[model samples]
Target: MSDNRTWRARLIATSAPAAVIWIRVYVGVVFLTEGILKFTRPDTLGAGRFDKAGIPAPGFFAPVDGVFEIVCGALILAGLVTRLAVVPMIVDMVGALLITKLPIVWGDAPLFARESGFGDFLHEARLDFAQLCGSVFLLLVGAGSWSVDARLTATARSAASH
Candidate 1:
């Protein structure tokens, strides 16, 4: 029984890093996709969407936001400085939720489908919250074992020793 418990503990210890890597990859991919979509057609999500959402200074803010998303998304996908890369995304999501999903807008009463009810809005909010959670996790945990940054850091440390 002790041996079984020890083995289980070891397995969990080993697998924890793998889980972080998996989450990072998934989160990175999603962020990259969103960034690409935003970057490719800034106008699509530019002042237009912000205006509809009633965010102030959309014209000034949209381009900056687009660039941050694109660059950070690429960095996350490449696993280069993963934690640092995701910081901007975490901030961006928080800003978006605050500006776009405020009480009044949320009270718009059709969060998802145009004709959907309050339940739909809650569902959409939940999904958005999940996305925010994923982003925050990546920002905190980083790219893990599969990352180029890890390899580079290890290499640098080894070279320094010699």
Candidate 2:
């Protein structure tokens, strides 16, 4: 029984890295899609949404934000220095929470007012928080065992020894 338990524990420990990698990959994909959408439709997303959302420096920051998202998202998906890549995303989400979420939570009146009150702000805040949490998780946990970084590192180490 002890042997079986030990074997089961080892199996779970070994598989944990794979599970983390899978989660990172999927989350990266989500960010990538969002980045792509923003990149392609900067005017609608960049100008219109930010302007409506009351993001500061809307004119200049919007395009910059879109580009940053695209680049970071792509890097995250590729698992190329994933933790490094996510740093910018973390900052961006922080900016989002500050610029957009705070205003919604505490600001007077809805800027767009399709519906009044803080509901929209709360929703946006929730989304931003979720994304931030995901990115942070990737940052702390890393790209995981199955990622390109891991494979590349392993290959490089093998080559060096030879």
Candidate 3:
């Protein structure tokens, strides 16, 4: 029994770093895809949606948000400056939840779902909340042992020890 527990622990330790990488990749892909879609389908998830949501300066903020998402997502995917990259994504998700999704939950139906019920509101906001939580996790935990940050830290340590 003890031997089985030891093996399980070893397996978990070995796989943990890979799990972080997977999380990074998953979140990065989501941000990247949404960013690209913002530009490619501007009338849907871009300025149009912003305008409908009553977000001020939708025309300017839409592209700006897209650029931030693309750049930050790319950085996170590369595991370079991932902590820094996720900051903006965290802020973005918070803004989305507050400015857009929360209102749906609170009774103000979104433009796309004015007829949707409270259950629909929860369903629609689920992804936003998940992304928010995921970004927070990445921000707190960083890129992990398999990342470029790990390599950089190792290099710095090696150099300092010399």
Clashes of each: 0, 0, 0
Ranking by TM-score: 3, 2, 1
Instruction: Provide the TM-score for each candidate, comma-separated.
Output: 0.73, 0.74, 0.84
lDDT of 2 by residue, 34-118 (tens): 7666657766777666777766677787777777777777777766677777888889888877765666555543443443346
The candidate, 2 or 3, that scores higher on lDDT is 3
lDDT of 2: 0.67
Per-residue lDDT tens digits for candidate 1, residues 136-161, read: 77655656666766666556546656
Instruction: Give one digit per residue, the lDDT tens place, for model 3 in 1-162.
Output: 233344322212221264689888888888988998889988889999889889999899999999999998888887777777888999999898778877776578567456355686678778887878877877777777787777765665566568
Q: Which prediction has the highest TM-score against the true structure?
A: 3
- Cα miss at 91, model 2 (Å)? 0.4
